[model samples]
Target: MIRAATDTGTFVPRIPLGEWVDTAVDWVTATFDPLFDGVKAVFETLYDGLDWALATPPFAVVALVLAALALWVKGWKLGLGTLVGFVVIAGVDQWANAMDTLALVLLATLVALVLGIPLGIWAARDDRVSRVLRPILDFMQTMPAFVYLIPTVVIFLTGPVPGLVATVAFAIAPGVRLTELGIRQVDAEVVEASRAFGATDSRVLRQIQLPLALPTIMAGINQVILLSLSMVVVAGLVGAPGLGAEVVASFQRIDVALGAEAGLSVVLLAIYLDRVSSALAERAPVARALAAAR
Candidate 1:
């Protein structure tokens, strides 16, 4: 018996998605070389400043500062854990690398917050803006992390700067989304009441909407930091120096011990940051309530 057309092999398209993407990237790189350079310079300045601050301090001093911060944010147990974790990283000779990773993560997070929060505010305030940004945010969040590095490398070349740029791009979506969500979730009655009290649009946003939405925004920041940390190892592949670089080097040389140590350092940093940020987010609601009470 003859097989039906439904049993035929799947059809293949002649379109070359890879080639199309490469061409688009090339065009953008050529068109915006100076813009990319300026971005690279800004990123480098921030990264260098943070790295210097972290690296110049005596190891013990740096560890103490981090422990203090943890204590301030999370309480004594996390503070002690952070102190011990940093000491262990230093003992394993990974202190510098860990600091480098921390610098990169923080820098990326700052950039993401700077850009994301504003976009989120815009999106939340305007229906058109929200509709336009939803798909873009979806794309940013769903795309593979490695895909972000491609255009970044083309525009900025391989280095910590490019890695950071890509990281901000990859990690910023949540910030925008959460901020928009938070602002939108603000009570309509509260916003109207503020406006009825002769508050201008900006005043209403600043005093009522943003204040109420702050907790959600803080959660967004927490997510951005976590996502930035997740990109550390992948970013290392493009010459981002830090624990990521160490992890990559270990893999290249088949040194399991080194990889494990570096990996553990990353884990420790992640835990510290996650806990502190989470605690801060938890505090936002209390802070808002106190402000309202006043």
Candidate 2:
């Protein structure tokens, strides 16, 4: 008997896309063991230093110092807010976990910025590079955050190291995209005039493009930081210690008070960092060159 053409059986064979990905991951891990170890060491050192700095101090003292930093950056109101926020977090007995989360977030943001800014600059200079990066960035941002943990966990096992690597990958896209946007948004006429007046590409970028782009760049930095905070908290699922641990514990044990306390502490830290970053964006100098050109 002849099979009907309307038969529902799929004609195409199933593609083993997952198996191919697994092979690639296995090969990379085997080949890059030494490189990953060196990277882990560096990240651990930076994390340890931040952890000690924040954790070793009396809660009051660390709070005051951060408040002072806020005062310097934004003014008295934010400084006061920072102080009170930390005190409340400490009151909830979530201070240590909060500090751990902060360190991870800060380190991840720093690394993202360092890598992103230059890449952004390059993309701004070259249309080809920008075109090439668009889809890659779209994939990075659109992929589920949890999927990032899979390769990292496979390669590095569970812990802050894997978490850190995953968090960095998750949080880096905005910095690159924004930096490119900010640089491209710089007034082209101003750039041309500077070039006409004997300014080199480097000089025009340093003195004109970057300064005028400061506000936008700062906005990008703010995003990088906020994303880092959220990702770091998620990282706690892999045995990374922080308020995330506390938050996760609340879910597992069905503890209301613990959830409220940990959740509030995360919110407090997020707001403080956000406020500082937003304030810094507003503070970016209005370049004299752009003003004179206008």
Candidate 3:
């Protein structure tokens, strides 16, 4: 005496959510190990290259150049501050590890911009995507940072790569969300004017909206980099190196002075990166124009 379908078929009950998820993960791991291996290999190659490049004397040379660039783009004060931060990190016997952390952070931030900016543009152009993305960004922003480390560990495995993966995941939402908001907030009249002038969708997006929205997108990038830096210690739990790992080790042993040093290093690094990113974002439109002129 059960409810009957139109056809003579029996219905099966759906699996519980917990069991379904576990089973799906198991299936994916079993079936997609090769795909995962390929991805890991690619990341390893990139990070390994970074490791070699940054572990050399040229890293210090590059730091000096970056300090000069900062002076030109921002101001003498920011340049001096950045130089001081680098010097402090280098002097504290943490140069290699600090560089490793910097490499991972810079790489992750670049990846986020590469992927997130397009998604943001898509969301901005379409009302439906914006509606869907807004809630998701809210979740990414509102969720506790520690909780992000768990799933990241399971997927990427425990190490610097996993930490980088988690840091990117944690930081990416803002860039996407802000980019969407910035583009959408562009003057409707200007967009209409572009359309009236026979601009294609791509032309309007590239020449009109994005140029106008560049500052906002730059702000988003700045925020993303800052957020990635904030997650460094949490990332260290999964084997991310540098001051974060030191912080973790010091805290484990209750070594107050060591922890303080690690913490200060992180703060200094954050300030340096933050200022540089902000300046770059602010300067992008002019730079783009100059590039176009060339």
Candidate 4:
């Protein structure tokens, strides 16, 4: 008797995910054109204002201001380093590009925080919401940064607007995750004590939970900033002008010196941002008090 053969081939779905996505995107673009246009205008206005302020000032003046900020936040050593780094960037004629990058990063980080913190707070307070958001946050975090640019360009048409939108989306996951974690990590006993003391839910959250969670929240903000900065190159590809554009140009032309200089400028900016944010996180009053008590 002949033995029966079993089917060993893997089954493939007939779903057209790509076409569905395209259709959805087309629907959104058609329906929300005005909203997207408004967003573009607002972002452009903010970017232009920041770029003008940084570029209009004499190089020495802007450098001094940044150095002073570094000194105030981090210390004398970092201040000096910041001053020298900016001077070097200016000397290499990359000051404008650096400033543009800074503007974009700042705007993107702001947008991420605005959207992330509230969502995080909600997630922390509700298990249902948290469960719903977990997969979405995971997808945002795991998706390649370049993947964001496609939909962004389709909707916003390749400019700093799309760049800012993509940067915010790419950078927002850490902000949301850390915010939720921070709030949830607040000591239960402390929370109960506040409740026992006649604290309202809002009061308990505002006075006790948020204060304790400040350091973690700050860390989230720092992560957002770093992620936004990391998107500079991808953003540049879509017409966002910055040091990233210079880096891309250098690559296309194979100008090693230009690439090195642009890369160095980005490094300097990263160092400055990282140090400043770290210092800020450390200096959160609750964080400082906790450290002292420990």
Candidate 5:
């Protein structure tokens, strides 16, 4: 079969992207390796400290306090759920695993918030940046959890911290996108009113825009936690430990009961975090109430 040389011309197969990919890898490694190593070191130190801490009655006390706080903060349902979830996890001998998972999720979510919020502020202020970032955020949100693990494995190796890194990458987009959206959605009238009172741009952002956008930003945080939980499980394939590792091991051994228990533990953890975050987000006031009114 002969085909005319249309717009394709010589029909040169597109140059393999492997070299470009390699170049990117090299650049990233060069730029971020030190930071990455520093992060790994800090995580390792904290993990050891936490593992030691968890070995004591104090850890149990902390858990009890958290359960109580959940009840205090959100209400009886969450508090009771927290207690029940902890009991179930403990009963399955997955309490430590569950805590490990919790730690990773907390750490990842924190990093995501720290990074995402600023990026979001930048996006909100710049139309061009927002336009560019929206699609990237969409891609991060839509990409499968497991797909992120491969590059994570290649670059960071396997374990809780590497898993934490990947979870942050996969889950942070919502925080950035939602924060930007929420900030932009702020009432122009209110903003003008703030300026009428002689507020500077920074003051308006801090006292007006951010306060108003808080609930929405919080909703984004809730989403980040949920997404982190989902990815953290996929991270088990790379030795990320906790319920996820147990789940993976169970599947590998075809131990239905074991896998089910692990899966249940993950679900419990998700529910606990989800409800707590949701409650907080919903409670933010209008001057504080982002999208909560809607």
Candidate 6:
């Protein structure tokens, strides 16, 4: 006699966690239909604007602008590299896709910073909030990036919308965590001094804390950007356009040249973004610089 496939030597209980999550999601979806619709409308408008702006310009003009920006921030070497990179992308006829992907990354990063920085400030201000958020951030950062897409797909269906949503969810943790850390690292004596001089909490934050923490916050911004770019590729699985979609198509067709083209474009964009942001992060503290100007 052989044991049945379902037979177990010892009894064990199974958890219904997934089912519970599904039920919760369904309820939220049903209850928040209008809210989600509003969010989708806003996001669609943002994406369309970015896409149009990026695509409307001549490739050479846009490339020149990017190169100039890079030159301004980091120096002439990065500027030359930026121009060459875009030229290569255009030579491969992947300029449109690269632009689309850049739009998505920018939009995703903006959303993350908008939401995460405020939450980080709140958490830094209150121990209870920090305690509450720590575990949640840990879970977010530790969870498999792909897992974010499932709920987004269920909520928004497959398209750029869900892809963007999933990318933001997957990439937002660092922004929040870093913002909090940067704020907390500010010297308590400085904060006390500001208060002693009749500075309000908000004033202290805007003039003292923010300027000092600019470098750290900028680091968080860089992480958010890179993470958004990484997730853009994953989000391509949901029909998000750009190099990621091209990469996915290459995989489907087993076309090495196509994959290489898209991959190289992505690498160029990443290096450009990383170098420029790193330069920004190393700049003088914002508040002190402003004071010096005065």
* Best-fitting candidate, scored by lDDT: 4
Give the whole-model CA lDDT for all candidates, comma-separated.
Answer: 0.90, 0.88, 0.82, 0.91, 0.84, 0.90
Ranking by lDDT: 4, 6, 1, 2, 5, 3
lDDT of 3 by residue, 1-294 (tens): 345454858765554777786678777867887887776677767877886777776656967886898898899998887788888877777777777777788878887888899999999988899899889889988989997887666667877777877888899998998899889878999999999999999999989899888888888999989898888767888888777899899989999988877887888888888888888876887446756789
Judged by TM-score relative to the true structure, which candidate is superior, 3 or 6? 6
In candidate 1, stretches whose alpha carbon ends up further than 4 angstroms from where it belongs are: 1-10, 285-294
What does the lDDT come to for candidate 5?
Answer: 0.84
Mind giving the per-residue lDDT tens digits that candidate 1 earns over 152-208?
Answer: 877888889989988899999999999999999998998888888899999988878
Cα RMSDs, all models: 3.6, 3.4, 7.3, 3.9, 3.9, 3.6
Q: What are the clashing pairs of model 5? A: 285-288, 285-289, 286-289
Residue 42, model 2: Cα distance from true site in angstroms: 1.3
Worst 10 contiguous positions by lDDT, candidate 5? 285-294
Worst 10 residues of 4 by lDDT: 1-10
All candidates: TM-score: 0.93, 0.93, 0.87, 0.95, 0.87, 0.93
Query: Candidate 5 on 35-56: residue-level lDDT in tens?
Result: 8788888877776666556534
Clash pairs detected, candidate 3: none
Clashes of each: 0, 0, 0, 0, 3, 0
Candidate 1 global CA lDDT score? 0.90
lDDT of 2: 0.88
lDDT of 3: 0.82
Worst 10 residues of 6 by lDDT: 1-10
User: 1-294, model 2: which lDDT tens digit per residue?
Assistant: 244445776455567789999999999999998998898788888899999999999988889999998998899999999999999999999999999998888888888999888989999999999999889999999998888889998877877778888888888888899889999998899999999999999999999989888878888899999998888888778877798888889999999999999999999999999999988776666743444568
